[model samples]
Target: MDIIPQIRAAMHTLLSTTTEAIAAAQQYVKRPDRAKFTPSTLVQTLVYGWLAQPTATVEQLAQMACRIGVDVSPQAIDQRFTLATADLLRQLVLASIQPVIAANPVALPILQRFASVRVHDSTSIGLPDALTSTWRGCGNATTGGGSTLKCGVQLDVLTGTITALVPTITGWN
Candidate 1:
């Protein structure tokens, strides 16, 4: 099946909703004066690229930015994945859900069995010693020098969308 149209439709829906969220949150005020990439542009470009190619790399993201007239380097694009960016993305994700659900209500009999279907999972990753101060990883029993980053995600099964992403340097909750 051709996926281009589906991707385009999804992108349009997400971008419009994210644009509205960015405006309401006044997210651009946090950026520096000479910032070339607005929060809306960055979110749109990253989401579109990921939707088009799930395994897309930073180089590919940079190319996508270029196509959208951003002209940013791969390093810059990678660096943009900071905590603030993650928070912005999370806000946009939450903001998009209401609109999507309102526009396309789920009426499948199988899905209607539950009030809400949420899937939760968590993972832990080892991090460099330097990030211990910033990220505050759990103390290692063997190698106390290293740190661990734990991330948890909650997805809405009916909508096939991520409802929450919780990142912590501490142990999983």
Candidate 2:
């Protein structure tokens, strides 16, 4: 079956999320020097353009904007997303889109009605390089190296979606 609809839906979702991120980020006025661009629209355009075809580029994004009559330049797009922190936007991409694109395991409807509850626990991703820092290091394990705290996240499993997730970050090494 064609996956165009699914991809289109995902693109819309990404656009909406990116828009919301910009709106939220705009409220934080703690920084005065931050240059302003249409954060929401720019991000939405980027994600939409990225999803629209097999080959998407910054130039293509600008073209898409032109097609939609948004009047954006390639440099403007870069300045909006790259020069700006847009940390909130990036965080949402990592936290939402990445996970959605990954293993979005959900409980079967038939299984959902069962009394049995699903459970998920902590998971870790170790870097190949040793983590040697001033504040943190590998734990006192002889094999793994110095006593750097283990890293990972604690996530809960649910029938329809992730109920909760707590990031497990090791302190500075």
Candidate 3:
């Protein structure tokens, strides 16, 4: 069928299943009375490489969702980013995908065989000034007032699917 329909169906299937990580992450989400991006849906977003994009903004993410027939606004998705609830979901998505990656199914590999999931890979997800102060002026050359921006990770340990994603961090000391 058309790409939108196909993507929509895939999104459905991705979020439809349940697992321990999903449950825990969901509880993590609701506990803070956060904005709406169910843990399952967040897991799907992270799993599908949506959040993995170095320069993917909420607007871009929402557009990606719309490509799959999801009509939510970028503003809404951007708001969800603050919850920090998605971090756990990111880990869960990585863990869940580890098996598919390891199998190297030659069909739909979630991660390439033996790829380095952790590295200095990121771009501007959104504009500099509009983001939170912490998100602005990154690395050692950053503006003094804000905290550093974060880059994300996706690792496949003896993989089938993604097994872990460390978080959008400022790298090591």
Deviation of model 3 at 62, angstroms: 1.4
Off by more than 4 A, model 2 = 1-14, 25-37, 53-55, 83-86, 94-158, 164-173
How far residue 51's Cα lies from its native spot in candidate 3, in Å, is: 8.0
The TM-score between candidate 3 and the true structure equals: 0.41
Off by over 4 Å in 1: 1-13, 23-29, 102-173
lDDT digits (tens) for residues 1-173 of candidate 3: 34677556544654655433465645665543644555556555544535558577776677666655556787767666643544555555554443333333233355455454432244323334544444444345444433344545443333334444444533212
- Give the C-alpha lDDT of model 2: 0.53
Higher-ranked by TM-score: 2 or 3: 2
- The best candidate by lDDT is 1
RMSD of 2: 7.6
Residue 1 Cα positional deviation in candidate 2, in Å, after optimal superposition: 16
- Alpha carbon lDDT at 158, candidate 1: 70
- lDDT string for model 2 (1-173, tens) is 65678777766765666556555655623343653334445665765687796467678989877765578678866655532345545455455544344334556786666654456566444433434443253444432543233323333333334544544434443
**Model 1: pairs clashing at backbone N, Cα or C within 3 Å:** none
- lDDT for 151 in candidate 1 is 68
For candidate 3, the per-residue lDDT at 80 reads 61
lDDT of 1 by residue, 1-173 (tens): 66678666765867766565664575543655777777767886798789889879999998888888889998988888776776677667656554343223456889888877777999877876656666655676644646776668777777666677676666322
Clashes of each: 0, 13, 16
Q: Which candidate's TM-score is highest?
A: 1
